[model samples]
Target: MYKINDFSRLSETQAAYSAGNTNLLLYDLPQHYSDEYRSYDSPRLCTIINGAKEISVNQSEHFVYKKDKFVLLPPNSTVHMYLPEHTKALVYEFGDQLIDNVRQRVSDKLNIDISKNDSHETFMQDTLTQRIDALNRRIQEIVLENDVNMSFLIDLTCQEMVYELLKIKGSYDIIYHHQ
Candidate 1:
């Protein structure tokens, strides 16, 4: 209900896949520069690339907005993210163990005997910026038009965008660790 996203997010893909269980979502939040809020049900991930965002968790706030910024929102998280004027950000709903998904793909793609070394969280994000923006724009176009066509388009577009993001992060194959 907040002005957190400029686009409409509709997707048929599961943002997280755990033992085959998938969480379905195609959410596009409005632009927000608000105070602390909470997600007592679902977990969220903020991948901020352009705009300025101030987020609060358990009543504590943190500012993040840059090509290198990303945050993990734990389930039932009493958190809020604030997006400043003229700001842009990307948010992902994550639950279960989506890191498995990233780790699997990264291992296969890079052919490295690599584990999530703490540096992998923000891997290749700059490479995915264009794709992320494109997806955001696509959703925005549909939302602004108030087009019923958004239903189908949003589903595909969001999935593609999310997929691209997973690819850049190396999917479930490369991001998770046992520790």
Candidate 2:
């Protein structure tokens, strides 16, 4: 539950959210900016959930279709997402077993149906942002009150959030296939 703008680098550009294991980043990509470097240059899964999504990985250019089309990278894989102006993206990055398990569980609830189409919506990004914002606000309230259960709340919020996020991202695929 971290805001990208709060970071020092976010004032000018997007950067790592924190030293923590997991974070969500929202940003827009410069159109026609990179035609040579075709990789994310980082070990992370990049999903283009809104606007035009173009990616070059393993030396091949591919367009990611919408409605839950996500790219899965297994660490150290350079990746990039091409987004048009006003593009919005919701990212989920973490490495803890518990965190992974929570995501997996939520994904299981959706039946793990990956999308083949690439059409996406900005509203979805805004919705996920709202959820994360709610979690951040909850943390602020607890910290302000000097609550002793801060850690528990934080952990609980992260787990529940991962589940919610996974569901929101893929529930369309899930609901589509399960029928």
Candidate 3:
């Protein structure tokens, strides 16, 4: 298992930012890089800004093109990913606590139960790619601005993303199962 929290704690070289409860990772690869199958303890939303990648989840392989695709990896799911040269990507890592908090907030707002589903899958949604792209740009802008309440803005943006994802049909089940 690839524990993101452990990686965050142990690695001083990897440039990562913390906003509220979210961890942001910007990966810029110059050459071929392959990541072996590993399970993430938290959920991840990845957007490919440039280049292409091959991702394998549960023996299903997917080719993700740049600027037109986004992947959502559920917690505790194993995945293999390969990035070709000149690949740039933004990955947002959401802690379990953050997800729980969001779930509660959404559930309370909508008056519904947001419980976990049995399905642990990786979703590639092209329809959400544009929104993800816009969100990524906004995040970069806020990070560069370095405002006093940067964390708050980032957290709010992340919450917006979660709500948007929930609006999508199939993607809803990725985070919660309706009761």
Q: What is the overall TM-score of model 1 with all chains considered together?
A: 0.47
Best by TM-score: 3
TM-scores of the candidates are 0.47, 0.43, 0.76
Q: Give the TM-score of candidate 2.
A: 0.43
> Scored by CA lDDT, what does every candidate get?
0.45, 0.43, 0.64
| Tens digits of per-residue lDDT for model 1, 1-179 | 12333221222233321212223233343455464444434344455445555655565546555545455444455555565544555455543444444445454765544444553222221323676766656655665676655556655564554455455434332223322
RMSD of each: 7.9, 9.4, 4.8
Off by over 4 Å in 3: 1-14, 37-39, 107-117, 177-179
Q: Give lDDT tens digits, candidate 2, residues 72-177.
A: 3333334444434334444444445534576555666566557553432111222325665565456445445755665565556656655554555543332222
- lDDT (10s digit) by residue, model 3, range 90-154: 77876556666766777666544434556556454554546766887888788779898888998
**Model 1: runs farther than 4 Å from truth?**
1-34, 43-51, 56-61, 66-74, 80-128, 170-179
Worst 10 residues of 2 by lDDT: 119-128
